[model samples]
Target: MTGEPILEVRDLCVDYGLGDRAVRAITDASLTLHRGEVLGLAGESGSGKSTLAYALTRLLRAPGVITGGEVRFHGRDGSLDLLAADAAALRRVRWNQISVVFQSAMHALDPVARIDAQLTDALRAHRSGLTAEQRTGRAVELLRLVGIDADRLRSYPHELSGGMRQRVMIAMALALDPEIVVMDEPTTALDVVTQREILTELMRLKDELGFAVVFITHDLSLLVELADTIAIMYAGRLVERGPARELFEGPRHPYTVGLLDSFPALHGERVRMEGIPGSPPALTALPTGCSFHPRCPFALERCAVDFPPTATPAGGSAVRLAACWLHEGGRELPAPLARSLGSTL
Candidate 1:
């Protein structure tokens, strides 16, 4: 979109638990979200995608601690360090400048309260200048914006359908017209058709409102259609990142290639479903050197002794970055990898 960056996350590290038992859930994860750009954070479960999102917004609870790094939020007023922002400052920024549509929309809403009340409460908390009547009018408009009727404003969360409730959550998040929105698997439980509908509506809204989105999900296939840039995370670290089209066309990292193969081809000759072998390594007991080396088919002798450096892949544009020794040259990659991503390297 060639827009100014609305949010920048640099070297963010997060952990869980006490010293001896601490697990590094996020390590040196960095990316930027431009105005109106959709940056997809894709990874398997426990890959630290959501952790990065939560840590950036300072929503991580006790036991989940941000150990290092910075979250710089560029808002209308100016630049503000989100990690260092105090309670009052955070209160002012959150909801007004940034908001989150958390995973599981059902859990996000209050079962007993009417949808209108939830929407107004957000407005009442952040936008005190709006009169009660104005807030109510805005609530109805928000529902309409999300393709829901104003008549449903009186309906409780439990009374609405899954898609409707999700739409309500989205409405609540956009109530303040925040500059950035963090959506963590916002369409997880919805049907494929419903999920497509919600995402289509979301992108339309984004185009209309010009708000940056940090969309976190495990579905790289879906991101290919919705995201402008995609960042792949593994074992608490970002393994590869590039434009969505380039990453899908020629993924340099073995993990990224495996992830692409895991999903069925939407518009190609049929191919067998090939899932990644072995389970993700536990953060507490991560393997030595590359955390993915234990399972990587292209693992070399050096892969066991030293961690791969995050650098530009061979012949790849500076925009394409990957952490894999294969990109550094000298190591002979597997025949299959060399055949599939030879140009990428």
Candidate 2:
């Protein structure tokens, strides 16, 4: 986390569809991923976590567009605005400087192709002048890096387990040794134990390889354990961002609080699971002020009409930032909200 940021996203905005039909999937979402650091993106579905990742890499299709903001990649060569990069430049950046592990690793892979071919194809595209032997060797090394044996490389996607498929996707992502990896819910369908193992392995690999990671998931508890920092999003806006443990222990935004409440404590006295009321608002017609206000218990009258500005709390966490009216004008939070935050339940 001490190293310089490998990727810097500033005022990044994304929209889906065209003209009046366009819905804002992400608005003013910004984040920085330092070299070798793991930054977790936690939000409910439709909060634009995956959209932000795809937008960052310029992988959006016809309906999805990057209307505003910049995604800068500061790699060993230099800094480049990814949004403005032409196809040729983008090809050089993808998998060479940055790579992505799609949501469904099984589906992401070519069912017809063996694991070895998929891994080598990435190498062949990016790393030119490599002989057959060299490519095969690199493929083996990559599989090994992800805790997969060389024998599995010959196996087809169907022959491998879900975890193996995920690791294979990860292995392919790391084939070029990119400085950053953007993963979109890479552990979605795996069992709990397998999910934990994969996350642990991913962190270990990140540390060893010295590559930053933008890990997106709906599981806040997993993020708290693996990410160095966590960013909580609601209705496409980042409502809170801070170190993982601090945000988990004392979330500043009501949305974040509700997300935490949804998960049961692993060690402490068990508490009833409480889900956030109502579904996430439709992007086509978002609320006027703070988007979370409709479901936020602490919402004040001002929250209905005025969008809250991002502010650091009075106590001043090292890098905590919350966009909420409670912190506006340096005002202390209402006693009830503060009291609720302090309570174990």
Candidate 3:
């Protein structure tokens, strides 16, 4: 998972409109995703996590526009700027270099089409060199790979269960041997048992295939366990990004901490989860200064007036970066945030 990065996104800004009426969904977000690694993107419901994913794959529609920055995708052939990639360029990389497993299983699959056809569609499009027999054989193998019965390939989307469809989607994502799979809440609607099973299979597949995963979820504890690096977004901006162990052991940003508090631990004492207090601000009319300041426990007057820059201090702080006044101007965090952010164990 080391060496050169497979994907480098620099200051990617996605906005919905113009002038004062504009609403930013993803702002100045940058990250490098290496191969054979899982980079988890976590945030609240309206934190633009999904929007960022859509923009990365050129899936954003209508008013949702990628206004600034660059998305550089590095592959074996060379580097391709995704931001500048046209429809034809995107077509080349769609399922081959990169793929996505959407959150809603039902919405993604075609109800009228048979399970085998739906699963083989991407392969048929991207790997058109394959004959019909070859594609069909691959589809059957894919079903088995995802733990579904190959015999069920003839069944329609309505025939399979929720978990089954999700697995089908995963199999499809891996069909073209994609280097990166951007999964957008892949197990959202499934039961806990099903979710765990899917995650286990996904990890197994990743290990076998040697491809990287961009797992997007609002669940912090899940991300902490599954991802090597975690990126926290708040109101269209990345408030924190660091190694999962460092970010979860003691969060640097208030929003990240709030998200952690919201998820119940899978192990240890199963205590009731606390909500993040106020609902996320409307994307159309976002707050001034720090978006999380309204709900922050250690908010200062300056927090409401100016935006904070991301700064990584020396020492073993998990490469912590927080876009809050507490960490701005190379200043030490306030006593409370420091005490909380610097928690031992």
Candidate 4:
């Protein structure tokens, strides 16, 4: 259901500070988002999911810097280099072209402002042509679009439930009819039922509005159901990316296999689950070679001495890519990985 490429991130890097003390937060992470596609970014916390989203949208705060690479946004009018764009150009593009819904609704929303005021603020800024009344009307319409009643428009953020506040944020993101929306763990705090409702509403809205989405979350299972393409990150690098179904069914990377095995299957019979052992490497003191080699059970000798290049795994789809030695030069997959992937690979 995706169209032509809308956003392309190539070899993007991000650092937390300046000079020799800077911590590398994201490194050479690249992905393409087609129009109307839901590209899910999944990883453990601090794997650079939110950092990448912020960097792509040029929303990274002070002390956080884009060290290298390009972010190209292809809009209807023309292609724009987001990394190189100036403040004025970025202002024009943000909200109007790309919007973001932060992880916490309580923190993202203005505590003192009414939902109506919060929603209309974006319209007032980006949509100057609209009158006050018109902005309010549009806000009401947006609230309704997100399944929020117009009557609650006057309610403050604290007055609404967690889900309602999140929906309001989503409504605000869609107010400008942006081409893309970056959602950073928008449902993390909500109950399972509320999470399902919000996600369902989000997907429905995406279909109706034709907007691309970069959904950042730690939940691979949820992404499996919602995202068209899924990108997996580890130690600030994109280790795997492919069509959602393919990545889930035939994960080629050992780290990916570990992640899948960590989660209990819903339909299958009960079985023992062994999650990834050890912790992610600290950004400041990452291992010399493959960052994950210490924790990878199927790592080769070279994996401890040299970083593996991104390569297409044997029997994987053409678009699939995994940064692991197991898939290099048509080498046979490890027994554990093959068993985990079943006959899919």
**TM-score, per-candidate, Cα-based:** 0.96, 0.96, 0.93, 0.97
Q: Give the runs in model 4 whose Cα sits over 4 Å from its true position.
A: 339-345
Predicted structure with the largest lDDT when compared to the true one: 4
Candidate 4 lDDT score relative to the true structure: 0.91
- Residues 261-329 of candidate 1 have per-residue lDDT tens digits of 898865767778877999999997998888899889888888888888888876467888899988775
- Best model per TM-score: 4
Alpha carbon lDDT of residue 37, candidate 1? 91
Model 4 lDDT at residue 76? 71
TM-score of 1: 0.96
lDDT, candidate 3, 41-92, per-residue tens: 9988889999999998898887888999999999866899998988898899
Q: After superposition, how far is residue 2 of candidate 4 from its true place, in Å?
A: 0.7
Clashing pairs in 4: none
Pairs clashing in candidate 2?
Answer: none
Residue 118 CA error for candidate 1 (Å)? 0.3
Report clashes for each candidate as comma-separated counts: 0, 0, 0, 0
lDDT against the true structure, each candidate: 0.89, 0.88, 0.85, 0.91
- The weakest ten consecutive residues by lDDT in model 3 span 336-345
